[model samples]
Target chain A: MKRRISLFGALREADARGYIEVDVPAHSTIAELREAVQHYAREHAPAISPGLIQRSAFASGDEILHNHRSVPEQGELAILPPVSGG
Target chain B: MTEIYTAVVDIAHGPLRPAEALEFVADPRFGGIATFIGRVRQHNLGRVVTGISYDLFDALALRTFQHIGERARQEVGGPMKLYIAHAKGDLRIGDFAVVVAAATPHRDEAFRACRLAIEAVKHEAPIWKQEHYIDGHSAWSEGCSLCEEHRAEEQRAAGLAATQAGDAHGHEH
Candidate 1:
């Protein structure tokens, strides 16, 4: 399945739209999605690191998803890097 | 009679208005009001910061603010009003990035609630800050250690759970 993940913070520098789209296996869990994204980053986005992707959290709508949770089939989700708001 | 205000939370794209926050928290019956404004500074980590751009997960950020307000009110144990807002886009040095206001019947509760509100926003909100430097370079600010702390705590908990399960299943050499 193809998923578009919105990016923020330092991750925004990876792409002009502040987001990236990657293909994942059907019914992929967040942990699997993280691996896919890390692979994508390595090949395409030098600014982002696999370690950062490992630490980043995925959010579906307003709720943050745990690693074991499955990615939804519809709509876009966000990839939240460690926050720095004041 | 005007309806009593409990909490007002927003993620604004334009400039944040401190005056509006003050006005929202104002009440004749309340004896004290406290406000905290966080502004973009010119210097950070010994580097000159020309400006900053703030990003947010809007829905989650607003929900976090409301939870902070409710928690503050519960902990302070008083009639309280809160106003919280954070900027969402590019801002120059000296521009306000966030504002928190609280009003309570007593000075102590007002102060405590205001402090709690701001601190919670700083730690819990899903917002990010990217600072632009004078050398035509930019970097995201090093965020608070809360995320790392949370991860550490989770690891500890998982370790404990695994140990307990091992104990139940009999130790393996």
Candidate 2:
């Protein structure tokens, strides 16, 4: 039994699947509900001060701030591409 | 007979009221409604508090909430209503932090169940908080020392307010 998701938090497009499965609630939003499923690139993500995080700032500011804000908290369900660390 | 059909996620900028939680649970049999409200404070753990930033680490917040609502439906063994709302963004002093309401026929059930609901939320929910001090510093209160910056700032602010309050009373007295 699949529940019809009212609002979703997953990426618009998954690797080969494209955006589909993730569904959140209608009123329940994270950080002003600004989402860009496709443009989830590491370099594009907001930069954080490394230690003292703005906490809600990332979740509340204008989506455009994603690029402009000095720091950003990685949103939940935000797709982070594979990273390699040695 | 009512249904558990709603849940929300938002920034708590002030005190969250549970009774007002009714708009979310619009079922008639719910003669008994139990609500809980959480507030933001000037001091948390003795930290000289300025402000805080809150965020949800997991979309699981709603998922868990829905699960709770469903479980309440089952436990109540009747048509029931439930709602949970939380605030986000920059919540200032004495703002609603969160509100949860559950409707039952008996007040006892409503109160007991609502308490359990909130307890589950606090322990199981994945909410986070970060503190901002009057100084050029901030920290994650989840696991950090209380900086004097926030307390000193709070005392100073309170003193200023108290002095004003005292002056007003003095004029009347």
Candidate 3:
């Protein structure tokens, strides 16, 4: 299965791309997705700072999840870095 | 139109109107309405800011707004009307950047809900800002630190609530 991740804020800057698709085994943990994202970033967007991913937060739907949480079988995972708005 | 619990969330390209925000939450049942307006400033972090451009992830941003509205309603323990709107694209200094309005039966709940909703939108909404400076250079800001503060406060409050519940259970035993 493929999990689509949407990037925003610093993570979008890091990816240099808005959307990323990662093929994964079913019910893959968020930790795994993070690793895949890191690897993808390294390969596709070398100019982006490495530390941005370390500071990122992931959200599935309305719930922000820890690294240990399981990624749903199908949904867009939003990669959010620190936000700034009023 | 008027409604009891209005949830207005939009990421707009044109200018934002404070009157629209005020109108969204207008209701006779509420004695108080609290509003917060964020405007683009002339300077930031020592740089003479000329203007700002906002970029947002639309679908996720709207979902986050809905989430924030729901949380505010739950926090107040009843129906509450909310209006959250943000500007996208380039905006000049002194223009309204964001508006958050909340209406409840009393002043306290309205204030609390408005505060929480704005903070949540700042912390959770997938919005990015780039400030253009008078030096002919622009840079993306590091984002608001208040989000971290809000998270820590929530954690502390949850811990306190849990401890109180535990103490009550112990007393019962």
Best by lDDT: 1
Comparing only chain B with the true structure, the TM-scores of all models are 0.79, 0.68, 0.77
- Tens-digit lDDT string for candidate 2 (A1-86): 11111111111112233322233334433322223221222233233221222211222211212323332323323321111000
lDDT of 3 at B132: 93
Model 1 segments more than 4 A misplaced: B1-13, B145-150, B153-173
Q: What is the model-wide C-alpha lDDT for candidate 3?
A: 0.72
With a 3 Å backbone cut-off (N, CA, C), the pairs that clash in candidate 3 are none
For each candidate, the DockQ is 0.38, 0.03, 0.45
Better structure of 2 and 3 per TM-score: 3
Q: Which regions in candidate 3 have their CA more than 4 angstroms from the true location?
A: A14-17, B1-13, B144-173
Off by over 4 Å in 2: A1-86, B9-20, B143-173
Candidate 2 lDDT, tens digit per residue, B38-75? 77778756667777665543355566566767766676
Per-residue accuracy of model 1 over B55-151 as CA lDDT, tens digit each: 8878777777877888997978868888888888888889888888888888899899988888778766788888899999988765532234345
lDDT of 3 by residue, A1-86 (tens): 78788876556665456777877778788778778888887898786665566556677766676777898775667776656665
lDDT of 1 at B70: 85
Lowest-sum lDDT 10-residue window in model 3 chain B = B164-173
Position B118, candidate 2: lDDT: 68
